[model samples]
Target: MTQMRFGQGTNRITGTVVMDRRTKCLVKRIQPGQIAVIDHPDLDEVAAEELVENRVRAVINAASSISGVYPARGAAYLIRSGIPVVDRAGADIFCRLQEGDRIWLDHDRVGKVGESQAVVRGERLSAQTVWEKIHQTQSHFNQTVVAFMENTLHYAVSEKRWFMRPLAVPGMYTQLKGKQVVVVVRGTGYKEDLAAIYHFIKAERPVLIGVDGGADALLQCGWKPDVIVGDMDSVSDEALCSGAELVVHAYPNGDAPGLERVEKLGLAAHILPGMGTSEDVALLLADQEGAERIIAVGTHSHIIDFLEKGRNGMASTLLTRIKVGGKLVDVSGIRHFYPPKTERRRKAPLWAAVFSAPMAVAALPGSFTIDDSWLRMVWLSLRLWYFP
Candidate 1:
């Protein structure tokens, strides 16, 4: 384990174990054997793999939010891989506590700040300053990415022809009749979109659908998803198993890891395979399934959004959007203008009965635990068999 160090006050939340531009960019720039200070302490498997593979030593989570909420998948991956993580006492708070900043990590719960030795008036820290972040060292690497974007187009080639898809669609009015369906996605400005979802849900009782990482975002908001759709890589296993109906957004090439994960968890999923974007598939599912109104959250609507995701082509996405444009509602900022529609709340008892009526008749309970989980999962699958 590396010794703790502190320096300077910046207003961004500290003690988070996140892998952002700061960490990735810094890792590429620093010399072979120097400590890298990170403001956020969160990591996903891919980013965590990068840090460990790079042989960077010691990370200081600068904020409590990294510890308090959301899946610290990257941080957990680091710990599980034998990387040393110094808690909320890294660069963020250390700088703020200069001379006698009084480290207060819940003095009542943990008792007394800095139970370990304190280096008062620590050598003025350098590196890890927020204002000094950069993207890459190699201009060639920058050039390659720029070139990819310059050539990127927004149409899908089908049978030697190209087509465009709409990102938003107007759904059949019946889809929104008595239910709420909120599709959550991971995009730039997602926090803002999440705020919109929070307001929409409070005002309208729509079912929440997490589109891959957006599902994880919903969990952070304490909103359970009614359904989750996407490729499974960015989402956590816990979210996939969170009693939400899983819809595997299969690539036109027939790849659907999301479906496989759902099956592995003994849950049911519908494999909707098409070329285009995962969000596009999600909207199609809502429209095809007769969802009264599909309210999308965290969907990409601009060139920068696609570029950030490394989407070199937007043909399928554009065309998919056009296909579903009629029924889809852009609720990205719906809260600002439309007050949530008021309707009689569906009785909780009805939901309970729908979920429990089958369990009530089963003479044996534990004997069917495995089967129930499996059965509940495949319920939609079976429904597709009959309905399709």
Candidate 2:
């Protein structure tokens, strides 16, 4: 990819427009140096990172980039990365502009080429403004938290009765009994978290469960998910066709929109009827199927994450965590869980260790006159660093 300085332009940009109502879907089609037109309100961190990865020339949002409801930082991220974002561009602009149409962004104004009048004009989000709004929103954090808890409890009461009933789990071919399971989600910093756990995954050989677009994340990292779970909205067709077992999460009313997509692909999927989020279902499934331990990577675990995902209540997640808390561990940044590049009982041969002792001592800082006690002190100090 070429280097990009997003907001360094002359307050103007002219490029082919790539428009999509869904920002996640749009990222797949967007190319560097192309303009992106999206209608996402309260754009979240994941979408912003994806957009940054694509290196779009600029972003034009038909909806508020930061609604000030709770400080969604999509605009801030783009701005900080030097990306110019024109916010609240008219919704009808989507109707007027076609994909691949050349357009012009003149500061706050957007219009098609050769047109004297601008199609839509919105407030340009600058770093100062976005941060100001974010700080202002922070002041209301307590209020948002209180309301969030109240709503969660309100919904939890109604949803608890459903949990009391038995959940009909689909028969799965993939074995989970006594196996360590890694449930992946496309949350903030998921890529980094996955990278941090690379050695742990290689050594332990955990069962990989990708939640929706997280399946694509695994495929990108050269790991094929054993079970792909979600409503199948953000995941790509390539991921769905990766020979992974499809377990679609269905609603309480038995509506399975994701199942329809699976059927269209000629892929067989087991429908899991549940009331909680798809990630919750994935965890509960693994726990019930006898997974010895569940490692959650990028799963939403806090109130802000729930708010960003547009969930007013995390009752299902709350209940599922309570049920599986014994074996569940969120390994988002805990890379030290396992030593790097080493597995249990896989020490070097005794002959190799003995043969290298002299060479190891020779390579140390001290001259050959160094005492044996000093060498031992240094060796002990470096033992942890040599784990790799």
Best lDDT goes to which candidate? 2
Clash count per candidate:
46, 2
- After the best TM-score superposition of candidate 2, give how far the Cα of residue 349 lies from its true spot, in angstroms: 23
| Candidate number of the best TM-score | 2
Q: How many backbone clashes does candidate 2 have?
A: 2
In TM-score terms, candidate 2 sits at 0.85
What is the model-wide C-alpha lDDT for candidate 1? 0.52
Please state the error at residue 162 of candidate 1 in Å: 9.4
TM-score of each: 0.48, 0.85
lDDT of 1 at 60: 45
Show model 2 residue runs off by greater than 4 Å: 1-9, 335-388
Backbone clash tally for model 1? 46
Deviating ranges (above 4 Å) for candidate 1: 1-154, 157-180, 331-388
Which residue pairs collide in model 2, if any?
6-82, 7-82
lDDT tens per residue, model 2, 87-198: 9997998898999999998889999988868988998888888899889888877888888899888887787777666668877899999999999999887877887776
